[model samples]
Target chain A: MEPIKIKLDKSNELLTDLMPRKFGPQGRLWVGFLLLVIIIGAVAYYRQLKHGLVVTDMRDFTSWGIYISNFVFFVAISLVGSLVSAILKLTNVAWRTPLVRISEIIAVAAITFAAIIIIVDMGRPDRFWHLFVYGRIQSPILWDVIVITTYFVVSCLLLYIPLLPDIAVCRDTAPASPRWKKRFYTFLALNWKGTSKQYAIIHKSINVLAVLVVPLALGIHTVTSWLFATTYRAGWDSSNFGPYFVAGAFQAGCAGVIAVTFVLRNHYNLRKYITNKHFDNLGKLLVLLSLIYLYFNINEYLVPGYKMKTVDGEHLHSLFRGSYAPLFWSVQIFGMILPIIVLLFKKGRKPLPIFIVSILVVVGAWFKRFLIVIPTLLHPFIPIQNVPESWHHYVPTWEEWAITSASLAGALLIITIFVRLFPIISIWETTEEKMNATATQTGDQTQFYGA
Target chain B: MDEEQSNSRRSFIKTGLITGAIAAGGLGIMEVASQDTSKKKGDTVKLLSPDGKIVEVDSSEINPQIPDSLISTHNVREGVPGKKFVMVIDLAKCKNAGRCKSACSKMHYLPETRSYIKINKMQDSDKASPYWMPTPCFHCDNPPCVKVCPVGATFKLTDGIVGIDNDRCIGCRFCMVACPYSARVFNWDTEYQINVVRFKEIKEHAACSTHVTGTVEKCDFCPTKAAKNELPDCVQACPNGVFYFGDENEDVVSNGDETVRLSQLLKDKSGYRFLEDLGTKPRVYYLPPVDRQFPFKDVEPGTT
Candidate 1:
């Protein structure tokens, strides 16, 4: 086992040091941009609700659109909490300490957005309670509700438990902050005194939660996939769906973390904390995920492509050579293949290039979900007849676009607010690592050193 | 004796005596009536059952009331108590007449795009002869839609008719996706605005769309009409008696003009189901379109 050691370090920062700091000019501008986009989306959604789903291009043939894809994206991004915090902790990977809190915050924000977006997709948003009142245990959607709630609980505990010590550090060190803010931090700190017993209990609880969260994460995405797979539609009906969706989820999640890391590294001058090394490692993980996703993508499409089964053939043709072909091929190449190719090389794995590539993978992945849901529905085994010609096709209206955008903005705003309150990179964990490195360099150096 | 029971017995005897007296005089009147209206309605006659019970009724009266029992929607869905609702479409009689489709669409108040019944133009293989097959909700015994509806909004009825409880639906449309037959439709918008007078008049007979914009809708087998003990509008409307609806329990089905035993019809006509390999156990059956009564052109584009 690695050497076990515990040492006390005091941080006497004031509350102002921990409370929300005002954004700089550039930060304000960035937030303003996201807000403007969100507002536009909101206005669009208002029209949709008033006029009905007719605002969007989506028709009976294409009942779902960009909104469902966005929902899938949020659900995918939420998986990072389990991967970074729970899985890493259970595996005893020490390097993951700095990333655990960041990943958990991202997880909470993404999942919250996921829940919201699903409701937005409803025809009668007011009937939301019907799901609970009449919920069937057999439905995959209900399973999703149950498992996601469980995941949210475990993730919140994991995030909160680790923050107690850090909250104590901020509480004491940041006393110059406003009185109310100070009280808030102090309460959140849970009077952590760094005792051996307290540390042991915290560690044990975290370990237990960590062990439990991975499967719940797997369950959430698997159930989401089952929503489509359980259907008899040509593209969605496949046993390969569970793993295919899981792989795509991890790929999207890893790219999201990369994007967030790059932005934080540049804005906060977190070079020492979120180093090039971190970027390179995350890039390698992204590549592995993209490759795995590619494998599943092949199975999802190519096997069906091979036989061109009578029922499945028309759906496949639409994806391969019809209206959706451009988007389909783009997602395959840019979302999975290109990212995998670029990340394989040393230069391409650098922070800047990986950031560009991550954005592509994420955007491309969103469109991939759109393709997965819509094309198959349009090609029901029977011919499109008897109904109006418009019913034969689907186009989403402006309101759908607005609501979908607002949901995205809402996710980002939560992340922004969280960062304003707490440092994106864990300050306490960084300090501890620095202290350990120093101790190793000088065997008897047990004193604090000013930066 | 209970007052209700004694009153019912009294009325029964009175009706019997009046019927016997009418029968005695009806024979003399029938001879003259038959000559006057042979094409319209033939003579009325007094009849005795094979079991030696005497009951006076017209020849047409026996068959007309025979259809009455099957017409009741409450009884239709309960399916003659022990009977299962089943259909057998004779392909030979179908040249895509589309009478079934139009009757279903108009009766259900379906959105112009949504269809409860579909007429598929199919050829099993390039070498096989082409035929037009009309499809309705199979109302499968083992329905995939029932299995995946998270809200229990869509369910399989006892007599093998799948149904939806619109009030409880969350509009998730999971059932629409789950159905292999593509029988479901989501109400994307309120199809029409309702007027109080019109709504009240139609309310008891057909759906008054309290159309929750996102919930699903599909074929309901004319349950409301069946309650009145009348033939389903579709069965009555079809010029070609292509659709034969009956109870599997009672082993009989009719199209108002013709009645046949359900088992004999299926066995003799070589009826089969759609997608039988999936084991959905569809309540609907099809008769092969080998010698169509109407040519393929009878479908007449835009009629549907």
Candidate 2:
């Protein structure tokens, strides 16, 4: 809870250093690569639209495929915006200042794709308007649509309102920037001269949004989980799915932040700003989130393991010892248990080791969504019959893989582009923290002498 | 008054014969009218008018062709009033001939890959004897498909049949997941090989009963046939009299050849519904396979 103390000269140095910088050759290549991947995905999606959902490996048996899993992953990763910004801000956490913008950018990007991937999964995308034309309140899909859109709007506001002052700073400092870039910043900054009234309004709006985003973020992920849990299928039919999904989402979001922080720190050379202490703190938070998720995983799996209801028994067997066992156990051990074990130690909480652990958590979380979706569908109550042998199993086709990878790349591209335009770390907030620390330190010295 | 009645009755008979001839002959009314000019004028055929009153007219006046749009768009949602349809499968009579499956496939124009009525080989446990179980849509009173459909594309009618509106279905396939019976199938690819001409003919007879690409389809309990008081295709197609279709409200069911009181048949045969404990309240009941028609020899539970 202690504010970070810094000299005025160092504070000014941090501000100028963290300003939006021009992309170097490596940054240009990365953006180009992302664009190429996105184009490939668009082409694949075009083919899907031209033909139908038939291009995918999904059949009557495994009706939902990688598209849905990708959607869940996006929604999961997006929860970090609220966790790192809204939750930490409200709780008076001081160390979260450097990571907030990165998390919010990631959230906005991931959520944008989360909405798109859902449409990509639809059988009749042309008739998507039918959802609005004949939407029923009873359907969980409608609830998801409502909450996700609400979350997306709230998240965008949360990302943008805080960026106003920083945008003003970029506008004032970057006179040599491109005409369009200057115009963009000028228009976006709303002519802010850092007046006290302007600051008050901006602060009040952000505070209101920060409070609003927490429950909306929770609702977005909880409702995404409900899309599956509301169903009668054995693996998906559990009251624990809501909390299970939220916990897993927090874990995944924290891992995303850790991964992004490490990259941004190296790429932007902001080592002085994003210190090892931030990684250590995030590492500990990851441990707590992973533990909570592990508890839910136990609750999710144990009851079915104990009762072994005929339908549930078959589903659990597939995850525990049958076809999905490798992916299942790997997700459990590496994604949850190993991360928990590694991050619990001081040495492992260091930046390098923790980054590795975060990568494992992320990759494992992606496959965990896959395990949740595909396995249960394969073990329907009735045995698979009268269908082609290929229908008996699901292997996502190349087109499906292309589209799913494109969505992931698309999320990354959005983050990359946003970082190119703005500071990954909040300059105004960091400076405010430094000033507060100075005030607190002088007050402590005064008290010591008087006593 | 008597003389007037006799005149009207004669004319009604004449109209009835002309209409029937045109329908049976598949000849256009204009062709028939032109041909009638060369025929003998003395011939008279008995006919009845739709109004129950007879009106004398030349046979040439009969128009056999009805406008396609005049084909009634009877609200398929409101089923046959005052009727609760049910089916009772006599498992004791089934011998795995797959006649019901083929008949159902043919009647519904289902592709060779899919069958609306599937004949599953079932055994309760490893120690139990296996038997052929022909499974169709249970038409549950509390259907999970109807409940989960976001657009009300699939619905359970009052007549105990669950039907799908292909035009309205957004093809989410949530209903397929909700259905425990695995009765539903998606029209994944466009069925280009379907006999479009025959399909069109069938569509004229049945409202909202055309298949489309990317929508879910399943056994509809042959509501089209049921509306006509005719046996569903599977009921009539089962050579061994395995399927009985009837109105549960009347408590009578017929297996094409023989009619039986439903309550009495169930009482005598110890009938039960599939997965009764699931509380789906299926309209289809099964008489358990006892006193088997064929031995459970060399037959696997889920193999053709």
Candidate 3:
């Protein structure tokens, strides 16, 4: 089949209807809530700065805590953009068109926050520039910096390039916009005139970025995983870390896309454009990704679990039977296993159930990162001695919670601002898709008549 | 009036004797306000040579240089010239007395919870018996910490000791996390200046009067003493003379009074570097904990 096409006359109301709109009451409330969370988080960070890292419960032994986990969580979730858009596009998956824009948005939002959260985890955020000026190639942290910056740039361009035509639509149709808003739209549209040459360039650039970004996306999270894995600590010393982290990243990324897709579909009243068919396809993709992740997870844990080296045993015991057991199992089951079960059933694959499952998967993946970081540090081979007892255990204080929550809020605020300025779904892409679908239907009808 | 004048003279003589004891031992007074009695007349002293011949020399010739009466505190931190300092720890003598740990903590104003030095109870292999292994920063010739430091905050000194410039340290703790020996400690919380200094004249020397949060700390080897031509506090404080402070340039090491050739002492004691396989080439050599003065017994763990 050629493609499904919808009518796209210059005067078509759907074209104008889908242009970026001013916020309604619900949009206002959402923006307000995100702002509130961000402000609270900023205040918390201020306290941390004034009082020092003592505001957090992190001590010498468990030096890393939830902030680092949250950083991993953001990096993992950001990987979904490349998986959904680039990987699917490369493999000729037709259903990804509607889902692609939101995935890229989440990618940009999550990656931006990932960078922010990692800085927050630093004892001296002020000295972050030192990383660039004096970076050592041998350190895994430097590798992460290089790849993550590359991923962010690629993700932003992926989000931006295809947006030109849509921004043009917004520029032309936005009625009596403010002077600055008009200029903003016009500049962003890059004078895109829907010419064959412009369309061809836009499509080609998207293709190139999609291809370049996939490996870089994978590289970013893999390198982030190595920050821990490269060490000699019990839980971190894994040969399987690269693949394990990549699999987990795709799982979280796919789940994030699903959750964002659900919210966008409802918020924009885009039931017709997004459709049940799109959700069904997404549900299947998520289930398959979850299963693949589960396979890698087994490889990560089971092989080491069997041998039970002295250091490994201490670390595994904490996650499996000791203080961290509850979180450890819950992340495995709810983050991976339960989502897999839900996605298996057709009813569970529907939009509403899939949305709920995606939320569960995301929450579970966050805790999974926490399990990866904290427990390993706690189980350092040497006995903990000669320090205050508090140094032996890690518990996040209010300031840590505030700073961490603030980073999450900051990501949400970005998404909120993005939605306010541009249509969450691409109006121009949807119009083009509709036109192609109609043309294909007409071609099929002509074929039947000829036969 | 007469009694006060006599009291002042007696007190002056007492001061002279105390000053004479330290000055006579090559701790020179570079400047003295008193009139030069030696300039009035050429006084000569007779001394016997090692070969038992008598020699006559001017009294001034007995002292080659007038050392600074008081080495400036800032200058003391700069270390001595023309020597690269090194240390050797005799593991055989360490019974985990942990006096070195406490003294270092007190001097550096480290928090009670943080220790720059850790005494690891290391077992060579699964089947081998355990031994008490005290670990200071190996201060590796090719230090992993110096390599990973994003800022040049932690640097290796020309004298072979690695030290941190606290003002430059951003306290990322990357150095702490990177160190394989677990030799690095972070100031995760600010430390209270506990007034560790005493003596009115020396109070000005205490620049470590405040501890900033978010910096890394480790064993400095008391550069403060190396400038004074004295052994590091750890080398001096060890009752069993476990630590040997030396200059590799001179090929001589001394634990306070007994000085010996560095190469000779190492050869005699069969000194070895710890974790030799790691390729760090540690400055501190170790003497094995064999033929010990005391039997190995498990000490109950405590937050010393």
| Chain A vs native chain A, TM-score per candidate | 0.90, 0.95, 0.94
Q: Write the per-residue lDDT of candidate 3 for residues A1-451, one digit (tens) a residue.
A: 2222323556776665555677899989988888888888899888888777778898767777898899999999999889977999999986777788888889999999999888887777788887777666776777888999999999999999988877877777655757888888998998877776777788889999988998898799889888877666787878889888999989899988888889877888777667777788888888899999999988888888899988798889888899999989988988889988988999998999999999999999888988998888877656666566677788788788877888888887888788778877776676666566566765532221121
All candidates' lDDT scores?
Answer: 0.72, 0.81, 0.75
DockQ for model 1? Answer: 0.43
Tens-digit per-residue lDDT, A340-403, candidate 1:
8999999999999999999998898788888888787788766666666677776666677678
Residue ranges of candidate 2 with Cα displaced over 4 Å: A1-11, A442-451, B1-76, B192-198, B203-205, B297-304
lDDT of 2: 0.81
User: Which candidate leads the pack in TM-score?
Assistant: 2
- Steric overlap count per candidate: 36, 3, 11
Q: Tell me how far candidate 2 lies from the true structure as C-alpha RMSD in angstroms.
A: 8.4
Model 2: colliding residue pairs: B12-B47, B13-B46, B13-B47
The fraction of reference A/B contacts recovered in model 3 reads 0.38
Give the winner by DockQ: 1
Among incorrect, acceptable, medium and high, the docking class of model 3 is acceptable
Sorting all predicted structures by TM-score, with the top scorer first, yields 2, 1, 3
Expressed as tens digits, the lDDT of each residue in B1-304 for candidate 3 is 5335434643554477557743432212222213233333477889875456999978765432221222322321233445677788877777777666665666666654445667667676888667777777777887867766766777777678787866567666667655656777666665442433352245323323235467677777766566456776667766777778888876778877688778878898898987676576788888888777666666724344
Restricted to chain B, the TM-score per model reads: 0.69, 0.72, 0.70
